[model samples]
Target: MMKTLICNMTTYMPKGYSTTPVLFYLIISSRHLEDIPLQAKKCRNSKVELVIVSNPEFIQELLPSAQRTALLYHLSYLCLAKFPKLERILRERATETQLLFGSSEALLLKCAATSQNLVSTLLPSLKAAVEKNKSVLAIKSLEKARVWINEIVDKVEQMVKRYDKHNHSVASCTSDVLNEKAETEKQIEQASKEVDALEKAVIGLNQELWNNNQEIGRIEATIARKNNELQNHIRESSNKNNGLSFMVCLIPFVGPLIKSIHQAQANQALAVKTQAISNELSQLSNEKSNLKNKEWNIHVRLTDMQLKLATMKLEKGSIPDPVHLNDVQTCLTRIQQILIQIKKFWEAVSIMLEALKDETFADEHFIDDCEMKETFLKTITTAQKHWRSFGEYCLSARGIFSLQTKDAYNFLETSPSSLSKEEWKRQYDAVIVKLNKICPEVCTPKETAAIA
Candidate 1:
C-alpha cells in the first residue's frame, strides 16, 4: 500500500506553453484551474491544506511521504499565490456581507446557492470555450463574473464604513427558536444529537476513504512499475541471448546467460509478484468503492436530520440567531460550489495540455526542446490563473451569506443613530407641511421652511 508519490505541477501547466519564444510573453491565457494542488488550496477555504499541514505524521493516515510532502508544498504555494491577503478577506467577510444583505443571513445562503448554480450552469460554456479554442469566449465568461467580483470587493470598503456602527451583535432575537415550541423540542434535540453522531462518523469515514484512496493509488503505481520492469527484464534477456554463439554459453562462467535463456522464456517469480500485487489492488479498490457508498448514505441521513432540525427552528422563529447558519456546512457551501470551476478547467487542461512527464529528459538528450523551459515560465506568469482565482474569490463571498434576516433590521430600528433619527424627523415634518399646503399630499424638498 506504499506509493512513490511524485507530485509535479509541470505536467498540468497551461496549454501551448512552447508556442512562444519569450519567457515573458503577453499571455492570453484563459482563466482555468486544472491542477490538484490549486483545487486543494481553494477547497474548504484552505482547511484541507491546514489539515495536511497540521497532521504532518498524518501521511501515514493519508498519502505516502513523497505525495504528502509535494501536496503540502504545492498547495501552500497555490494558496499564497492566489490569496495574497487571506487573513484580511476572512476577517471582514461577515460584516461586509451584512452590509450588502442588511443583516439577513438568508441572503448569504441565497447568494451561495446562486453562485453555486451559476458555476454549475457555466461549466458547459467553460468547456465549450476550451473545446472550440475560442479564447474570447473564455475571457468574456470570466469578464462577466469579474464584474460581480469587483463590485463585491469595491462595495466592501464602503460597506465597512457604512455599517461599522451596527457591527455590534444584536440582543437575543432568537430566544424563540432556542426556547420555543415545547412539543417540537424533543424532536429537535433528538435530531441534533443524531446529526452530531452522524457528522463524527462521516468525518471519520471520509478520512479513512481518503487514506484508502491514497493507498490504492500507491498500489496501482507499484503495479505499473512492476509491469514495466517485467517487460524490460524479458526484453533485456532476449537482447543478450540474441547474436550470442551457442559455444559462448558453454563456458564455465556463463551461468547468467543460461538463466537469461530461461528468464527470456518466462519469469515466474516476477509474474507471481505482479499477480499478487494486482490481486491486492483489486481487493483494496473494491473495498474502497463499497465504503464510499456507505459514506454517502450516512451523509444523506445526516443531511436529512440537519434539514429537519433547521426547519423546526425556522418554524419556531429561532433562526434569527446567527449560530443557526454560521457553521462549517455554510462555509463549505460557497467553497464546494466554486470548486466546479476547477473541474471544468481540469477537463480543458487534460485535453489541451500534453503531459510531458519527467521521463522526457531521462537520457539527458535535450532535443529541440529549447522553448519548453520558457513555456513553464508561462504557466507561472499567466494572468489567466489570476482571473480564475479572482472569480472564485468573488463567488466564495457567498460564505458571508447566512439565514438570519431579523437581526440587522432590528438593530437599525432599535439603535437608530442621531443623524438618521433627525433626518427622518426633518423629512416627515416637511412632508406634513407640504401636505397641508397642497391639500393634504406629499412634501417638496424646498418646503422645509413651511414645515418648521
Candidate 2:
C-alpha cells in the first residue's frame, strides 16, 4: 500500500458572495487513485472540494468539526461538513425573508433529489487533478524499477567476476600438474637411459666372467693334478728315507767290508730319487705361495666391486619398486644362506685340521726323541694351521661368489647384456684366487724331506 497527501486548488468563492467561507474538503478512499471515477452529480449540490489524502493521519485534520457525520456508499465514505459555529452565525443573521428563502431552498432541494442522487459537480476538475497525481506516482514507480534492475545487473557482474577468478585458479592448477607430470616423465626417461648403459656394461662383464671361470677351472685342474703328483712323491720319499735308515742300521751291524759295497749302491739310487721328489715339492710349495698372493689380490678387487654395486643400488631409492622388490629380497636371502654355509664350512675345516694334527703324531719314529718329537709336533701344528687358514680363505671366496652371483642374477634378469666380458673375467679370477687361498694345501704340494 502506498500513501500520499494531495491538495485541491480548484475550489473558490464567487464574486458576489459576502461570506468568509473556506472551501469544504472531503477525504476520499479508494483501492488505487486511478480506480476512483469522477462524479459530477455528487459535487454540484454539496459544494465539496475533493482532495485525495492517502495518508490516514492527515485525514483527521481535514475534518475538525465536533460532530462526526457519515454518508455511506458501497465501500466508500462521503462526508458533509457541519459545525455549531457556522450554525450560530447563520441564526444571528435573522433576516426572515432570507431564512424563509433558505428554508424553501432546502425543502426544494430535498424534494427534487432522489435518495441516490449524486452531485456530478466535482467530477471534471477533481478527475483531472487525480489523474495528474497518478501520473506522478507511475513515474516514481518506474524510477524505482530502474534502480532494482541496476542492482540485479551489479550482482550478476559480481557473480561473473567470481566465476572467472575460480576458472583461472583451476586452469593454473591444471598447468602446474601438467608441468610436474612432464618433469617426472623426463626423470624416468633419464633413469631408463642410465639403466640401458649399465646393462651393456654388465653384459660385457658377464662374458669376461665366463672366460675367467673357464681359466679358473683349468687352473684348479692343474693344481689338483700337481697336488696328486706331489702327494705320490712325498709318500715315495718317505718310504725311501725309511728304507735308507733301515739300510744304514743294518749295514752297521753287518761286516764292514761286504756292507760298504752294498750300501753305497743302494744309497746312491735312494738319494737321486729323494732329491728329485724334494725339488718337485719345493717347486709346488713356491707355486702355491704365489697363487695364494694372487688369489688374495683378486678377493680384494671382487669385494671392492661388490661394495660399489651395493652403493649404486642404495643410491637408487629407499622404497623398493614392485618389479624389483621380490628379486632383491630373494637375492638377499641367498646371500645370507651362502654366508651361513661358508661359516659352517670354515668351522669344519678348522676341526679337520685339528684332527689331522693328531694323526701326524701317530708316527712312532718322528715321536721317539722328546726334543725331536716337540719339533715335529710344532712343524705339524704349523702346517695344519696354515692349511686351515687356506681353507678359511676358500670359504670366504665362496661366500663372496654367492653374493656376486646374486648381483649378477639380478642384473641378468633385468638386462642380459650389461657387464663387459673383461669385467666379468676380472671378477671370476678374483673368485678363483679367494678359493685357492682358502685352501692353499688343496692348490699346492706339501714338501718332502730328502734323506742323506
Candidate 3:
C-alpha cells in the first residue's frame, strides 16, 4: 500500500496543486496507513504505503518546485497521524519559507487556522511597530505646541515692557503739571499782597496832599493881611505931608516956629520908618518858615511815592498788570517834576532875599521933598515887584501841577500797550530834561543811575 501511495503522489501531485486537493490527498493516504517500521510493514500493508515511508529521500527528491509549499502544507497534515516525528520541523521550515518569499497577507490567511506557533511568534513585533508609530506622532504634536507656547510667552513679555514704559512717562508728565500749577498759585498770592499794600499807601498820600493844601491857604491869607497894613501906613503918611505943606506956604513970616514944627515931624517920620522895617523883617521870617514846611512836606510825599512805585514794579514782574503799573509810574514822574519846580522857585526866592538884605535904604527925612518922594516910590516899586513875582510863581506851579495830573490820569485810562517802552522812556527823559532846565544846580546822580 505505501508503494502504491508513493507512486500515486508522484503521478498526481503537480506543481500547481490547490490547497484543498493537496490536503484531501494527505488525509486519505494517512487513513489507509498503519503505524509500523518501514522494514516490518513491507509484507503486511500495501506496497504503496510501505514505499512512502521506506523511501522518504525519494519523495523529497521527486517534489516539484511549484508544489513545495503545498506539499509542505499537506505533509504537515499527514504528520499528525502517519509522520508525527516530522511535525515541528515541517511547520518551522514552512513558516520561514513563507516569511522570506510569500506576501504577508497571503501567508497569514493561508496559515491562520493551522499555524498557531507562527501567529504567536509574530504578535510581539506587530504590537511594537504600532506603539512606535504612536510615540512618533505624539512627539510631533508636542513640538508644535511648544513652538506656539514660546511665541505667546515672547509676546506677553513685550507687552509688559511697553506698559511699564508708558506708565513711567505718564507719571513724569503728571508730576510736571502739578509743579507748574503750584508755582502759578504762589505767584498769584504774592501779587495780591503787593496790590493791597499799594492801595494803603495811596490813601495815605491823599491825606498828606489835603494837609498841604490847607497850609497853603493859611499862608496866602497871612500875606494878604500884611499887604493891607502896609497900604494903611502909606495913606496916613500922605495926609500928614499935605498938612505940613499948607502951614509952610501960609506962615512964611514965622520961619523959626515953622522950622521947629518941621524938625519934630522929621524925628517922628524916622521913628515910624524904623518900626515899619522891623515889621517887614518879621513877615519875611514867617514866610520863610512856611516855605520850608511846604518843602519838607513835598519831599516826604516824593519819597513815599517813590517807595510805592518800587513796590508796584516788583508786583508787575509777576502779575503783568500793565495799566496799573503805567499809572503809578506816570504819577511818580509828575510828582518828581513838580518837586523840581518847587526847588527852583525856592532858589529864586533865596537870591531875591539876599539881594534885599544887601540893599541900603537911605534915611531921607532931612533931604528935599522930591528926593523923599523918589525914595518912597523906589521902595514901593521893589516890594510890589517881589510880591508879584511870588504870586506868579504860585500860579505857574499850580497850573503846571494841574496839567501834569490831568495828563497822568489820561495816560492811565488809555490802553497800556499804546505806550511802547521807547516812548515811555522818551517821556520820562523829557521830564528829567525840564527838571534840569529849572534847577541847573540840582544833583540827579541817583536818578541817572536808576535809569541806567
Candidate 4:
C-alpha cells in the first residue's frame, strides 16, 4: 500500500516543480518513523512547507524511545508554516508521555532551531540522536551520505562537458576577430598615402592658376594701349580726307577772284607809266613856250632895228645898209622852224593821254565793290591763320612738316607775280592738301562764311 501511494504521488506531481516537499510529505506518512524526525529536522533548517502529520499516535508507537524523543524535539522547532491545533496537541502528548518534558534535548533543539543560522540546529540533534542510539543513527547517517555523494558525482560530470564546449567556441571567435583587425590596419595605411598625394597635386594646380591670372592681366593692358593708338590714326586719316574734299570744292570760286586781282594790278602799273609820260609831256610844253617867247622877243627887236635904220636914212637922205637886212632874214627862218616842232610835239601828247584815260576807266569799272573786296581779303587772312595753326600743330605732334606744305607757305608770303598762273595754282593746291591733312574743320563752308 505504501509503494502504491508513493507511485501515485510521483505520477500526479506537477512538471518543472520541486520534488523535495513532496518527498518530505511522503516520509511523514510512511511506516518509517525512524527518518521522520531527521526529515522534520531538515525541513526546519531550510525553506520547506510540510502538511500536518495525521495519526500521531501511530507514528509515536512506531518509533523507538530515542527517535520518539528526537521527533518531539524537532516538532518543537517548527516555524513559517504552522498548524496551531495540531502543534498544541503534539506538545500536550509529548508532555504527558514525558518524551520531551524538562529535557535538555528538547530545550537545546528549541534554542538551535530558532536561531538565525540554521546550521547551528544540525550538530545538537545529531549528537543527541547518536547518544541515544549510536548504531541505528550511525547506519542511517552512512546511507544518507552515500546517496548525496552519488548525486554530486553525476552533476560534476555534466558541468565538465558543458565547460569544454563553451571554451572551444570562444577560441574560434578570438582567431576570426584578430584576422579582421589586421586587414583593417592595411586599408587605413593605403588611404593615408593617397590623401597626401592628392594634397600636393591641389597645391600645384593653385600656383598654375595664379600665374595664368597674371599673364592675362598683362595681355589686357597691352591690348588697351594698341586700341588707343589705332583710334588716333583713324581720326587723323578722317580729318585729312575732309580737308582735301573742302579744298576741291573751293578752287573754282577762288580762281575768278584771283584773276581779277592780277588784272587790277596790271592796270595800276599801266596807269603809273601813263602818269610818268604825261609829266614828261608837260615839261616839253613848258620848254616850247619858253622858246616861243624868245622868238617873239627877237621879232620885235628886228622890227625896231628896221624902223631905226629908215629914220637914220631919211635924215641922211640914203638907203639902208644891205648887211643888216641879211642878218634879220636869217633870224626869221630859225624862229619859224622852232615853232613848227613845238606844235607837232603838243599834238602827239594829247592823243596819248586820251588813250590812257580810256584804258584806266575800263579797268576801274570791272573791279569788285569795297565790301566784296573786304570779304575776300578776310577769307584769305582767316584761311592763312588756320593753315599756320594747323602746320604748327603738325610739327609739334609729328616732329616735322611736309616739304610741299612749307614751300606753299613761303610762296604765299612772297609777291604773287613771282610764280606763274599755273605754278601759283599748284602751290595753292599743295597748301590745301596740307590743311586737309592737319585739320578739316577750318575748311568747312560755315567756318569760311563766319571768317568772311
Candidate 5:
C-alpha cells in the first residue's frame, strides 16, 4: 500500500528509492560546464547526462515493479524533493487513482476504453490525408510517437521479466495487507450483526418484564378483592349461625352435622381460590426475574460486541489499500497492438512519399499512342490505386495517444519538479497554483523556469 510506512520495499529490491525531495536532475548548462569552477577542471570532458544526474543512485532500484511504478512512489522524493506541497498533490492523485480502481488492468482498461471514438472518427480522416493527400507531417508525427512508445514499452517489458519471481513481485507483499484489511472488514460486519441481534433481544426481554409486572399487579388486585369478599361472607355466616344454632341447641347431634356442612361455605372457597392465585403470581414473579437476568446478560454482550466492531472498523481503516502492479502481459500487448497500427499506418505514408517523389522517368521516348507508352501510363495509374490501399492500412491505428494511459504509466528521472511537456507537467502546475496562491508558473523559481 502507498500509505504504508515501509522500509526499503523488500530484501529483493536491489536499491530503495531516494528519500530526497527532488524529482529530476538539473542540467549543468547548455554550454561549457564552467559555472561551478570547483570541479570544472576535473569533469571538463564528462558526459552531461552524468553531471546532470548528480545522484547516480536515484534512477536505479532493486524492485523491477518499483521501476515501472516509481512515479507513484519516489517522484515526490526526487522532483519535488524540496517542494512538499507539490509532492503531496502527486501523492494524493496516486492514492486516489489506485483506490478508485483496485487493479492496474482496470485502470489501463479505462484509459484504453476512450480510444474507440478516436478510431471511429479522427483516424479515418488522418488515413485519408496520408493516402489520398499524402501528408508527410502526419506520418512523421505518428512515427515519432511510435518510436518513443516502443522503446519505453520494451524497457518496461524487460524490467517486468527481470524481477518477476514469485517472491519479488510486489503483489505478494501487498496481498498480505489486502488480506488483513478484508479480514478486518469481515469481523466488523459480523460483530455489528451480533450487536444488532443482542439489542433486539434486550428490547424483547424488557417488554416481557413489563408485561409480567402488569400480570403480577393484576393477580395481587384479584387476591385483595377475593379477601374482602371472603370477609363479608364470613360475617354473614356468623350472624346466621348465632340465630339458628342457638335455637337448634336442643338437638345437639343435628346441630353438629349442620356445622360440619357449613365448613364448605363461600368464604372458605374464596380463601382457597386466593391462595391459588397467589401461587400463580409468585411463579410469574420468578419468570420476570429470569427475564431481567437474561436482558442484563444480553446488554453486556451487546456492549462487548459494539466495542469489538469498533475495534475491527478502526483496524480496517488503518490498513492501507493495496497498490496494484500493472499487468505486464496486458500492458505490453496493448502497447504493441497500438504500435503495430501506427507502424503500419506510417509505413504506408512512407511508401506514398517515395511514390510521390518518384518522377515519371522524364523520358521523351515514351508515348501514350505507342504500346510501350501505354504501358508507362498504366503503371502510373496502378501506383495511384495502390497508394489508396496504403492509406487504408495507416488509418487502422486506433488510440494512438492517450493522457490516461500515459498517466497510468508515467516515469520520472533524478530531477526536481518543474514544468515540462511530459505527463506530470499539469500536476506540477496545479500544485504551484494551489500552494503558492499564484497561478501556475507565476512565481516560478528562475532556475526552475530556465530548466522548464
Candidate 6:
C-alpha cells in the first residue's frame, strides 16, 4: 500500500470534487510527488496511461512534509558528526541569535565569557539568518547580536588603553631611579676630594709641630746652662765675702796694740824728764816760800821807811840833816838784802808755776802737738823775764836811795853848825819824802782817790 505525503488533505481540499480537467490538474500540480508513492502490484497491473502535465503553481508550491522531515534529519546529522566546523559556526550563530531573541540573562552570560573569535565567526551568520527569516523574531535576534558585538569591541579597546597607561608609568619610574643613582655617584666623588685636601693639611700641621718641639728643646738647654753658671758665681761670691768679714774682725785689736806699745816707750823717756822737772819745781817752791816771806819783810821795811820819812817830816823843824858814809853804808846793806830776797822769790815762784803747768798737761803725746806747746812756752818766758828784770831793778834802786838818804842824814847830824837846824831838818825831810816816792810797792800800792 502507498502512503500519501500530506496529512489532513481533506481539510485543505476544495469544497467539492472538481469535474473540470483543469481543476484536477491544478490540484495535483500543487502537491509534491514525494508526498505519495505507488505500490508495485498496482504499477504492474495497470496499464493506465495518465499524462502528468505542468501547472503554473507546481514549482512554486509548499514543500511536502516528508521532504521537509528528511532535510531536517540531514542537517542534524551534519551538525553532530560529519560537518564539525560548520556545526560550530551554526551553534555560535544560534547562541548569538538567542542573545537577541531569547533573554537578557543569556546575552549577559555570553558577553562575560565570549571570546573575539566566537563573536567574529558567529555574528555575520546570525545576521544572514535573520535576513533570510524575514520575521520580527529574526530581526530582534539580529539587533541582539549587534548589541553584543558593540559591547565586546568597546571592552577590548578599554583594555588596550589600560595596558598603554601601565607601560608609560613603568617607564617614568625607571627613569627616576636611574637619575638618583647618577646623583649619588657625583656626591661621593666630591666627598672624596674634600677628604684628600684635609689629609694634606694635617700633614703640614704635623711638620710644624716637629719644628716647635725642636725649638723648645733648645730653649730648655740654654736655661740649664745659665742656671749652672749662676750657681757657680753665687758660691764664689759667698766665699770671698766670708774672708773679708774675718779680716775686718781682726783689724781693731792689732792696730791698738802696736800703737800703745810705741806710746809706752816714749812715755818712759818723758817720765824721767818729768821727775827731774819735779825736783826743780820742789826746790823752786821752797825758794818761793822763802821769797814770799822776804817780800813781806820788804813790805815791812817799806812801811818802816815810810814811817821814818813821815817822822823826819814831823821833826824837820828841830833836827839838822847831814851826809855820813857809815850810816849810808848800813842802810844800803839792809835795802840790798831785802831787794835780793824779793828777786830770788819772784824767780822761784815763776819757775815753780811753770813746772806745775807742765805737770798738769803731762800727756805722753803732748809734745807731738809742737805748735800749741811752743806758743805756751814763749808766753811764759816773756812774763818771767819781765818779772825778774823789774824785781832786780827795783831792789837796786831802793838800795841806792836808802844809802844816799842815810848818808845825807848822818852827815847833817854830825856836821859843824854851818846851816840853821830848821834848814837842815827841812832838807832831811825832803830827802826822805823822795826816798818813799821812788820805791816800788812791796805790798799792795795805794792809788790816789780821784774824787777825794
Candidate RMSDs in Å, in order, are 24.5, 66.3, 76.9, 88.1, 43.1, 99.9
User: Per-residue CA lDDT of candidate 6, range 1-452, in tens?
Assistant: 11111111000111111111110000111123222223100122322111111111111111121112112222221212222333343333323322221222222233323323223433333334333432333334434544544554344344334434433433343344345435434543333444445445545544554554454344334433432332232223223332211211111111121222223344454334433433332343333334434433443344334334323322322111111111222222332233232222222222222222222233334334444334333333333333343334333333433332233223312222344657545654554444334322222102211111
Model 1 error, position 219 (Å): 12
Model 6 Cα shift for residue 227 (angstroms): 87
Residue 216 Cα positional deviation in candidate 3, in Å, after optimal superposition? 4.1
Give the distance in Å from residue 392's predicted Cα in candidate 1 to where it truly belongs.
24
TM-score against native, each model: 0.24, 0.26, 0.26, 0.16, 0.19, 0.19
Selected candidate, larger TM-score, 2 vs 3: 3
Give me candidate 5's TM-score against the actual structure. Answer: 0.19
Summarize candidate 1's per-residue lDDT along 202-229 as a digit string, tens digits: 4675576466545544544443353334
Q: List the residue pairs that clash in candidate 4.
A: none
Which stretches of candidate 1 lie above 4 Å from their native place? 1-266, 320-452
- Residue 109, model 5: lDDT of 32
Error of 6 at 428 (Å): 6.2
Question: Clashes in each model (backbone N, CA, C under 3 Å)?
Answer: 7, 37, 14, 0, 17, 10
Q: Estimate candidate 1's alpha-carbon lDDT, on a 0 to 1 scale.
A: 0.30
Residue-level lDDT of model 4, residues 1-452, one tens digit each, is 11101101111112211111111112122222223223222233322222211111111111122222222122121210122332343333333223212231222222222221212222233233334433344334334433432343343334334334432432333333345435434544333444445445545544554554444344333433432332232223223332211221111122222223323443455434433433332343333334333433443333334334333332332322222223222322222222222222222222212222222112332123444233323333333333233223323322211221222122213343344547644644443333223311111111111111
Q: What is the lDDT of residue 400 in candidate 5?
A: 20
